[model samples]
Target: MSQFALLGKRRFAPFFLTQALGAFNDNAFRYALIGMATFRLGMSSQALSTYNNIALALFIAPFFLFSASAGQLAERMEKARLIRIVKAMEVAVMALASVAFMLASPGMLLAVLFLMGLQSTLFGPIKYSILPQTLHPSELVGGNGLVETGTSLSILLGSVAGNALMAVPHLGPQLASAAVIGVALAGYLASRAIPPSPATAPDLRFEWNPFVETWRVLGFTTRNRTVFNAILGISWFWFYGATLTVQLPLYTRNYLGGDASVLTLALALFSIGIGVGSLLCERLSGGKVEPGLVPLGAAGMTVFGIDLYFVRPHEALLREQNWWSMLSGAGGWHIAIDLVLIGMVSGFYIVPLFALVQERAERSQLSRIIAGTNIINSLFMVLAAAFGIVLLGVGLSVPQLFLTVAVMNAAVAVYIFTLVPEFPLRFFGWLLVNTLYRIRREGIDRIPEHGPALLVCNHVAFTDPLIVMACVRRPVRFVMYYRIYRLPLLRPLFRMAGAIPIAGAKEDPELLQQAYDAIDAALEAGEVVCLYPEGGLTADGEIAPFKPGISRVLERRPVPVVPMALRGLWGSVFSRRDNFLRRARLPRRFRARIELVVGAPVAPEGVDAAALEARVRELRGAEA
Candidate 1:
């Protein structure tokens, strides 16, 4: 289903609007405070900078201090009720903000900023952890996409509204203040429509100490290596975004020679790019959580960021210009495209990581894990600010800082991908399969979401494993002929995927037994194991008699066997049709339509080579 369809559902729509409104209000108030400090307060440049930094610090402090408590609250109480309470707090806080705006009290506004931060901290755990409960595994990516798109657009609109309204004649502060309060109230009304999200751990005790509880929450986040690394990836993204965003105003004024309106235009383009990228993830991933996109995103961000630095406008053009004038100027479009592409790649990088965390973390601890993520995110943002300050203190120009960040991004990406090779391995496989074929999967849901299942398929081509990997959402270990497994170019991918290499019993009895042992071990670890029952690719584009080795493997570890069939691949470049060498020299069938049909799983006791072969034959029909 289209991700937009989620907007019409009761389960998602109300929460989406509430969250959007809250985000809008937060940005609106923040931009208003910044505008006041800069233009209206008559403060000197250094004092204005100090106040701006203080405001940012205040907003981030609550995530560090209160995320643990907030996570526990969401776990201990009904989520919808908690949301309503948070929205009500927003309304009260905004009312106080209105008073401060009228009285021109900067201290009160700063306190209100801290209050807004506290509210967001309380809502963070509930926002993310509630997704898995409300969305199916298939819908997680799409759902996350919609939420991210909404957030980016909200931030854009709110920033525009706050700054634009506050610049009005005489009634500016009142108008901005009223706008925020109205948004807060609207958010409360939306929260009222959210269906109940019952607490996951209602009986759990709460810990009030921020230090100890923060440690506990972070520990929960580290329980799974992949999930914890995914969180780090997310936090790193925040660091990147925070550093760039903080520099934009100055970058516009000094580097690009653009006025405030041009800065707004740049930000708008970035926001729109993120929204587009986030929404596209659902379609790109085929409604599954595809972490492969994360690597693609990271690569794009590094490439585009480096290109941005090289393409920055020369200092000769550093004179203030309006939005349109800036766009029409030399090097303007390049800078704009770079910023937009960077934001788009950031969306691709972040959405999948969020979905992976949601799908992988233990349910009862999911809230705490998200809370931990927020704490880390806050830390990263703070560090990014400090890093930027130090770089600037060392006399690096804004464009130079961009170059440094791009280089740092590359280094960090390499480190992370090396630590978890699965991401890059999957990216390569995903890229190859997606580029080579238009794969259609039928009855894919018949495969279990979790647990050990033996998958038996009639392999039609040498690329069958890649095809299966592309179609199935779960990680699968494949058993392949040793020769194919050791193919020079494909060996690394095979090894990374942990494919078990098998030899004929007559050729190597020890290797055959070891292959069986590996299959059994994979099943014991609750992983999906797929193997071609015909032992090798079909020579005549027809199902061969299934080998009995499957039965032997199941004898040691009896598990459900799912039968699958591949169609429209028999004559492909990778298939052994019309002479393998001759076929390899022929034109590749790029983007060929292929179908993968999955059959109902048969219990181990009922599974036989002949029956499974018949089932696969039925699925394939005469397509081959």
Candidate 2:
């Protein structure tokens, strides 16, 4: 539970150190470039800002252009060796950066910046793709949190060190260059300590054309929808961060009437918030990679960002005030608080999504999928820049821009959940089932790893779907009645689960069409879709005639049909025969046995609706 335990092992420590140092050096070099442009070279503010913006643009650009290739490289090569090569490249780039600093050459500095971006792009796939390989599934969330927190902290420290050293007058360039080289050397040494990671795609042929290759990489998304959407979620976070991080300096100088030190305050506060939130992941997740936290984090980001926009910008500043002054609540502290909140929420938002992608992505294609993800992230960041430019051109102020971004985040989060409702709906069902049922699952291994599975179960209670979902490791889309799907209390819950709402044949033709389409899509996508074949809940604690819904879906897409039986929920409140007061007044320790017994998959050709129903009834009889 102690967060530091994440770094205590060989699996994590080396990679963590290497990544942390790289992040530190990245900021250090960027800061050094900014310093040389501004004070050392006697450039104007406008020129300095222009160079800084260009450096930012260059650094982020490779994520789009090279992410797919880098991801492929990660899949094809040994991660340990790849990291070593990457660190070596960093060393060479730092050497160029040293020369640029010594000569105070803007051209060389800009070129070195691009090299740094390229190095990061190459490292992107290996960086995240290696975690799932190295750590147990349980440790993934905590481990990612450590890396994120450390990276944020390193950036904060690196920026301070770079800017502070640059102010030393006599020792500025030497100190900055030395620091960059030192970090690079440390990263190289740490990378050497990394455990060897086997190649995911050893025989993968290298593609020469980036455009074509990038398009090919996207096909992986279609195969795994959850991983793909999680990738989108991650990219959206980058878009959100891009908008805020890029504007902070200008906001501090022009709006808050502060100098460089105030910018440091904003950065430090934000980084510290990330560290705090990241560390909390272990506790929040209860040591599991809980994707439920993703929505919560996204919600927080939007709410706090809006609050930040509304924060009154400080009109004046005391010159004597330093970093501590921002905390003193005299000038622009509201903006500082908003920054901290956003960073903290972002930490919570991102770590789980990354862990989910790693946990869900196929091991053989994880790196490639990660490569796909990096490309998307880069693309979104570009889109974010475009969005920012458009907003600015439309005469939006910094605060107003922040507000718009907050709204945009909310819209995007809803869109993602709508596209993949299982995350949120499952979370809802999970909460309810965990709270109400003491479920004991047996024969869980009977569920096939990859294939369509028909789950035939005895009617137990209205809450059966929730109980089944809670015990099953995978998400399930349940086929339920239109009325149940429209229950105001459970509508949000079902909506998220992507539940299929069916109408009786005589009720509505369009609803039936939608139901069949949803069921087909769910099974075709390799998801588990469950239905109560008895047509409705057992009103008299007896299984009814099996409905034809399961057979129809199975007929379309022949996969495994698993027959299940639930026992001992006949008199519960959720069951039909419950006497509300008596059931509520029942002793707390009811000592009931409720179970889900998974049977073998039914072959499509041999199974009919009646035959499947008979098998389910037999299982229920056996259990009873």
Candidate 3:
């Protein structure tokens, strides 16, 4: 089903609306306060600046103080009930904000900002952790995409509404106040329609101390190295985004020489770009949590961000032009496109990391992990603010800052990819398979979701491992020939994937024993191990005899063996059809159609190498 189908379902729509409205209300109230401080409060420029900064700090303080406890609450309490409580609290907070608006008291409005932040902090853990329970594994990426798109749109609309409504002559504040209250109440109503989502850790003890719990939650996030690095990647994205967004107004005024409408134009383009990119993720990922897009996003961010620095408008055009005038200017479209693409790639970068964390983290500790992520994200954002300040203080132009950030982004991506090689490995495999073949899989669901299993497949070409990796949802460790495993270009990827490399016992008995030991250990730890039972790629367009080594491995592990076949790959360039070098000179077989067919698994007790080979050959009937 299309991911949009989710928008119509009771399982998703209500929660989505509730969350979007909450975002709308938050931004509306925030911009309303800023509008008051800027134009209505009659304060000095320096005082207004200080007040704005203080307001931001007050808002972020709650995330640092309460996110850990909030995570624990979500895990321990029923999620739907908790969401309703949160919505109710938002209504109360907005009601107070309305009073602050009426009284025109800066102190009261600032307090409301802090309260709204606290409310968001409380909702953060529940917001993310509930999705995995409510949606199917297949819908996780799509669901996240929709949520992100909705939130971005809400923020855009809310900011516009808040500023526009507050500019109304005499009753602007009253209307703005009423708008936020109404939205908050509507959010509460939407929350009422949310179906029940039970707590993941209902029996767990609650940790009330925010400091201790914060440390404990962060420790849980680090328990898995990949999960930890994914969280870091998420945090870095927030940092990058915060830096760019905070500079937009300055960038518009100084570099683009545009007015207020132009700033709004830039913001709108970015928000819409993010919405477009986020919605596209479901289709691009084939309804799975595909981290392969993350590298693409990072690379795009750097490329376009650097390009943005060079796309600056001439200073002569800096004279009081409106958004339309700016658009008609020479360099205007370039700047707008750069901003939009940056936001779009940001969507690609973040959604998968979120899904990866949800899929990989311990289910019972998922809420806490999300809370930890929030804490780290907040920290990064705070650091981004400081970094921007230091750069500006050093007399760096906003465009120069953009260039510096792009460089920093590249460095950070490299560091994170090194820490967690799975991301890059998956990207390489995804890129190679998708670029070279139109892959179709049949009966892939027969592969067990968990526990040990031996995957026996026909080795049709040198790229078989990558093709299988791209098609399967679960990670598979391949048992490959030592020569292929050690191929200079593929060695790092193979090692990262934990592929076992084996040689003939007579040639290297120690290495062969180590390969068998690694395979046994991987299977015993409940991982899938794939073996090309044909032993090597076909020199002819035919299945080779099955190697008895598979039977020997099963004798020790006694795991069920799934038989699979690759069709239409025997004649590919990767196969030794004529000769490796000779085939390379032939026309590239780009996007060639191929299929992977899986047969029902055989029990360990009844499995035979020849029988398995026959089953695979049957699956690959015409191709073999």
Quick one: best TM-score, which candidate?
A: 1
Residues forming the 10-long window of minimal summed lDDT in candidate 2? 312-321
CA RMSD of each candidate after superposition? 1.9, 5.4, 2.3
Model 1, 369-427: lDDT tens digits are 99999999999877887787778767787788888998899999988887766688778
Error of model 2, residue 410, in angstroms: 2.1
**Which runs of model 3 end up more than 4 angstroms from their true locations?**
36-53, 103-106, 313-320, 578-580, 600-603
Ranking of all candidate structures by their TM-score, best first: 1, 3, 2
- Pick out the ten consecutive residues of candidate 1 with the lowest summed lDDT: 44-53
Tens-digit per-residue lDDT, 91-194, candidate 3: 99999999999898899998999999999999999999999999988889999999999998998888778866786789988999899999999999999999
User: Per-residue lDDT for 197 in model 2?
Assistant: 89
- Candidate 1: clashing pairs of residues: none
Error of 2 at 251 (Å): 2.1
Model 3 error, position 397 (Å): 2.8
In model 2, the runs with Cα more than 4 Å from the true position are 1-6, 35-49, 286-289, 314-320, 331-333, 386-395, 427-449, 453-473, 481-483, 486-496, 500-525, 531-624
lDDT of 3 at 302: 98
TM-score of every candidate relative to the true structure: 0.96, 0.79, 0.94
Q: Which predicted model would earn the best lDDT?
A: 1
Between candidates 1 and 2, name the one with more favorable lDDT.
1
